[model samples]
Target: MVSKKQRLASVDALRGFDMFWIIGGEALFLPLFALTGWSVFHFGHGQMQHTQWHGFSFYDLIFPLFIFLSGVTLGLANKSLRGLPVSDRAPVYRKAVKRLFLLILLGVVYNHGWGSGIPADLGEVRYASVLARIGFAWFFAAMIVWHCTLRTQSVIAVTILLGYWLLQTLFGNLTPEGSVNAWVDQHVLPGITYQNRAYDPEGVLSTIPAIANALGGVFAGRWLAHHSGDHKAILKGLFMAATVSLLAGFLWHWVYPVNKELWTSSFVLITCGCCLLLLGIFYLVVDVWHWKRFTYIFSVIGCNAILVYLGTSLVNWQYSSKSLFGGIAAALPQQAAGTFLIACGVILLQWLVLRFLYKRGIFISP
Candidate 1:
């Protein structure tokens, strides 16, 4: 049997792969559209960009995928803590709280906290952030997992989805200013919202539905834990659940509409389904089949995801990349070629930084 203390390679690789897109991996392929003018590259480029309002895109999947994976880690962590005394769990809870607030604080920093010196006014800060959403969803989902049985957790997940849909129907429309989420953010959130708009994608009300994504990951993690030794069982269970989730999501989209901005019920269902599907494939190839070599880069990045995520904001990686590789890009025959080369250089530099941390066992997580 696989030891609970041991990490799942597939999880790390999948996380790094997801983070890849966030850290400009999309640019590597995006420039292809301009260079070759191929329909295929155009389609790939389209997939990299988020849907404007009320649709799904591959880019939309990235945020929830990370949150879902965070839930999976929480589940596995809970499993490891199962046999411990109640008193021993205190530090675990404390650490969870610390991680939650830390991520939230860091999210603030990512939103330009102190970037232009201190904000002259309290309202200058944008408190809603991607990392903050992850922290909130993971924290609430962890609380549910700590208290509830699987069946109860399942019920709660349903309640959250349905309840959010019902509330949206009653109080919110799809518009930026009219969204119930916008109202919530304006009234409750202390500082500025995203782009100083009425609605923040990671705002107060929208976060309620995001918890379902984390819970879905918890369910996946539990399934993996239950069938740790049975590879076939794991694949079958994951695929079956994913199929059901996808069907449900599509069906609900007729009414609620799948949207990443509001993070509607349908959006949560669809993204969670895709996440499960991706996790299943990653597990099959990376873990079940033991294909470990190619995944090393992803594993390194995943090990220190938060670091690179924040690094992109705090550090001038693009400047550094251009400083080192600008001449190389300039020497390329075409502007598109130069753009692609610079993108590659950016990723290479980020990977080297991650590799350095990975080799020295310097992983930093929330």
Candidate 2:
């Protein structure tokens, strides 16, 4: 039996796999497409990019996947906290709020607000951001988990999804300009809207549904925690849950559509289904079957996921890659090959830094 205190390798590997793309794993296939001119590579490359306005892509899964994983981690971390005396829970709540604000601050910096230099005015800053959304989603989801029972949590998830759907239906449409998300950002949200557009992808109104995504993860986490000793049961339960979620998502898509920018309710259900499905597969392969060798790199990156994310923005990896692998890229036969080499170099350097931190038992959580 796995100890309750033990971390799950599959979770880390899944997170690392998601982070892989954000840190340029998506570009890894673009050169292959350029070199081979094959449909498969072209298709793969396309999947790596976001859908411009509406529709789904492999890339759209990346952000929500991380947010779901954050909820999973939160659910797991709070298992012990939940058992503590009521008075002892204060620290946990404090820590949760602190992490939320810290992530918001980091999100601003990640957007180059403070990192680039002080903005001329508050309006110059783009406050709605990827990290900020994660913060809000995880924070509210954590609050739900901390106070509610499994049944209550599930009900709340449904309520939030339905409520969000209703709100969007009444106030928003699926266009970049007409999106309720865009409207809220432009009129209500502080700081300039993302790219000075009508809407920010990570804007305020859309986060309502995103909290449901995190709650889905919380549910998954609580389930795993409840059944830690039975791997087979866990596998069966996850697969079955995923099947239902996916079915519901597809059915709902006929009405709501799976729009990533708006983060439609259907998008939440579909992505959470994917997340659960992926978690189950990873659990079966890595945790249940004990096939650990190939996933080592992902696990390494996963252990220090936050550090690498912040590092990519804070550090000049492109310059470093060019310094180290410029000659190699220059020596390549084709421009595509050179571009691919440099992309790989950038990923390699980041992975090496993550590996160093992982080896030294250093992990940045926030």
RMSD of each: 2.2, 2.4
Model 1, 119-172: lDDT tens digits are 456667787899999999998998888877788889999999999998888987
lDDT of 2 by residue, 1-366 (tens): 123475688899999988998787888788988988898989998899888865789899999999898878766654544566878898878888998899888888888883245545776788888888999998888788777777888899999889988888888678888777877888889887667788888888998889988988877876777788799889988899899998999999998899898898999999999999999998888888878874788998887887778887889988998999999899988999999988999899999888888889887887
Query: What lDDT is obtained when candidate 1 is compared to the true structure?
Result: 0.87
Q: Candidates' TM-scores?
A: 0.95, 0.94
Q: Using alpha carbons, what is the TM-score of model 2?
A: 0.94
lDDT values for all models = 0.87, 0.84
For candidate 2, the per-residue lDDT at 180 reads 77
Worst 10 residues of 1 by lDDT: 114-123
Please give me the total number of clashing residue pairs in predicted model 1.
Answer: 0
Which ranges in model 2 have alpha carbons more than 4 Å from their true place?
1-6, 77-86, 114-120
